[model samples]
Target: MALMITDECINCDVCEPECPNSAISQGAEIYEIDPNLCTECVGHYDEPQCQQVCPVDCIPHNPDMKETKEELYQKYMIISAA
Candidate 1:
């Protein structure tokens, strides 16, 4: 699954730079994770970097954008190719 920044985000700004896919960005109110570009750091790290750095723990798996580990790796490969 992709990850999402919830309303609980404190705008701490730590998560943005930690995203290997560059999927996290400053939204109108909070940081938002773009599902299309998110791979949960599958090919880059053992864990989601943003989730690791987020102080408020507002980032969570996006149930609405579920994907298997294989799918996430595919996405990561595609993104890396680009």
Candidate 2:
């Protein structure tokens, strides 16, 4: 599943650099996660980096764009390959 930044995001920019997949980005209102680029850190890390570092705990699983662990790994590999 992709990780989403909720309204509780403090915009402290803590989660941006921690994302191995480069899925998090700054937005007008709050930080945003690109589902297409999000692999939930499956291929790169044991757990989601953003969620781990977020002080506000605003990073949440994106149920609307769920993917199995294998699929997430494949997605991450595909994007990071190039």
Candidate 1 stretches with Cα past 4 Å from truth are none
TM-score of 2: 0.95
> Which 10-residue window of candidate 1 scores lowest in summed lDDT?
12-21
Per residue, candidate 1 scores C-alpha lDDT tens digits across 2-32 of: 9999999999889889888999999999999
Best by TM-score: 1
Candidate 1 lDDT: 0.94
Pairs that collide in candidate 2 are: none
In model 1, the number of clashes is: 0
Window of ten residues with lowest summed lDDT in model 2? 1-10
Residue 79, model 1: lDDT of 94
RMSD of each: 0.5, 0.8
